[model samples]
Target: MTVGQRSGPPIPLLGVEEEFLVVDTDRGEVVPEAATVVGRARPALGTRVGGEITKLQVETRTDPCQGVDDLHGQLVEGRAAVQAAALSAGLRVIASGSPVLGRAVPPPITEGPRQDRGTATFRGLHDELAICAVHVHVEQPDRDRAVLIGNHLRQHLPALLALTANSPYWPERDTGYASWRSVTWGRWPVAGPPPFLTSARKYDEHVDMLLDAGALVDQGTIFWDLRLSTNHPTLEVRVADVPLTAAESAALAALVRALVVVAGDAVDGGDEGPELVPELLRLAYWRAARDGMGGHGVDVTTGRLLPAAALAERLVALARPALDEAGDGERVEAWLGWLAADGDGATRQRAAAALRGRLTDVVDEIVAQTAPNVPMSEESTLA
Candidate 1:
């Protein structure tokens, strides 16, 4: 069935989880100070601020929001809180997917049984796992519907990844992919594109199979590009990098919510979900990572190549009805227009590097884009 064939119900309530890399403000190197930052941020943000798997990453979540405008403001506030907290420690929070320059030695992991076990099991796999991502959660009543929506959402993941591709550098050199984080993440046992599924039962069955094979330590380790949340009644899209700024992150979240809405409408219309070759879907992910928004992308419908920007346009068109209905049509379009003219995080990072001939400049660019003009509240400011 063609995408955007029909309008969906009112936009589902959505929320965003944005992860950030903590870095030394002056030297621009990733720092293992997430605990300090999260500790400081929690006084104001409460449960909204948390530590990630690594000590260098901090994550922020906005409460479920009804509209893009509210979500955007929350995102900005969350970023500012983290920025302020990090600043208090002589550190900064940057939104790059991978650090421009990491320590010569491996970074420290957060101490937890699950995290420790994973560290023991994966060993060096977690070395480059300092990567960050922007996860968008759209509310669903149950896991079954969420799984069905995921099937419909799977085909669009690559395009979404292209639009939010922000990780272009790894350590000291460019990885030559728009999202090196996605590439590094694919090395996980349960990562990358998920199997074509028909129901929540199938999803559970697949999880059991992975568990039996020792591929996953627990159900929570199912790191598909999309999945049903273990702790919430939402379908989580974990494909995109942590965008360069709150505005871009908000726009990407809006698009994701629209996509989920459109997919749900199709399911209600009796569409079983489109099934594509698993190998081709993997290739599509690779293309999206390699080219991002500035190069060619795979047309998931036909398994053929299309320009990345055109694919993005096609995705926007597919979600137009939902966007218009949700009152986010203009804002999203304007953001897309800006993305086209200025490029995505990868493009901007490359431009910064070229202009200054230093990776530190790229970090500075990210720090500036993250939340430049927004005034921090007195509560969030450093003492």
Candidate 2:
């Protein structure tokens, strides 16, 4: 069945999909626990968390909401539920894009058709690639806007990467990249920024051409950096890696919402900020993937190279108007400042690892930093 066009008012909404690793706390190894975790959280099953390829990973999605405040609450509740359930099942939830201590072992595919297809397809593509990510979806008024935002947002993707750079250590060693997960994920055939689709009709035509050529089974296979969701009325931005904490996740979501509102307003005003050719965008993405925040940057429109931090500053300046328009300027600035000060997740993780000399210690720090507070029950009595 063909996916229908997006239907909604111009009011922006936010949804977050966070992929987490199931870790054995004692050994610091990846373990397959989809059945155990999903079984235990049956009541909250499908409502908050769901299974992903390889039982080692699980993903939780927040219900769609109109504002960041509500979105934050959903994230907190969902994360709390998942953490409690995971702890109960002898597993711990980790927020890194790729776990540092896990060995690559293919886990059984839990019963489902789409998941089965995904597992088979990925296994055929590459081995030793079990990474997780956080995908953010924002509701678009229509498909044309979705396509436009998808293209324009490509320029700002690096800045987002700099902010959400988790997963420095990979496979028990320092990958020497801020977000190795980004590199690992790029192995997929259709991953990365998509070719510009100017309108809904153009996007549909591209999908049709791919299907006609037997390139894909359906829209589900088109894993662009940003794309219209196959089953939802939202544009999915799969750029940022999963962060280590719910606050970080919410911060990333807030940035995404701000971008959509900014881009949507620009489109509505007939101001297409600047033209970015495909090659230039690719180079920028490559640099971001390579050096992350420490890498060179590319001009969004002209493709001229610049320092990554300078480009990030320019992006923040460009986004200021939109943040102000959305009345979220303070929050956005604070979030960006945190990233700048801490130097993204990759840098911080490396620092922790270097200081502590243990990858598990780094993971423990991430968990402690990101986990939500558990309130004490009022009726509890001391033994």
**Top model by lDDT, which number?**
1
Question: What digit string (tens of lDDT, one per residue) describes model 2 on residues 1-383?
Answer: 11112332344777889888777757667778856776676576465778876677778888887666677777777766666677776666778888778675443455678765665555655454467788899887588878887767877886677667787777788877787887877777677877766788898898888767655656788877788999788889888888877777887777787677667777777664455677777777767766677667676677787877787667767777555655556776776677768777777778777875887777666655555564323221111
* lDDT values for all models: 0.86, 0.72
Per-residue lDDT of 302 in model 1:
81
Largest TM-score belongs to which candidate? 1
Name the regions of candidate 1 deviating beyond 4 angstroms. 1-10, 374-383
Per-residue lDDT for 143-246 in model 1, tens only? 77778888888999998999999999988899899998899999988887787888899989999999898777788888888988888888999999999989
lDDT for predicted candidate 1 compared with the true structure: 0.86
Quickly count the clashes in candidate 2.
0
Residue 89 C-alpha lDDT in model 2 = 67
In Å, residue 250's CA in model 2 sits off its true spot by: 1.7
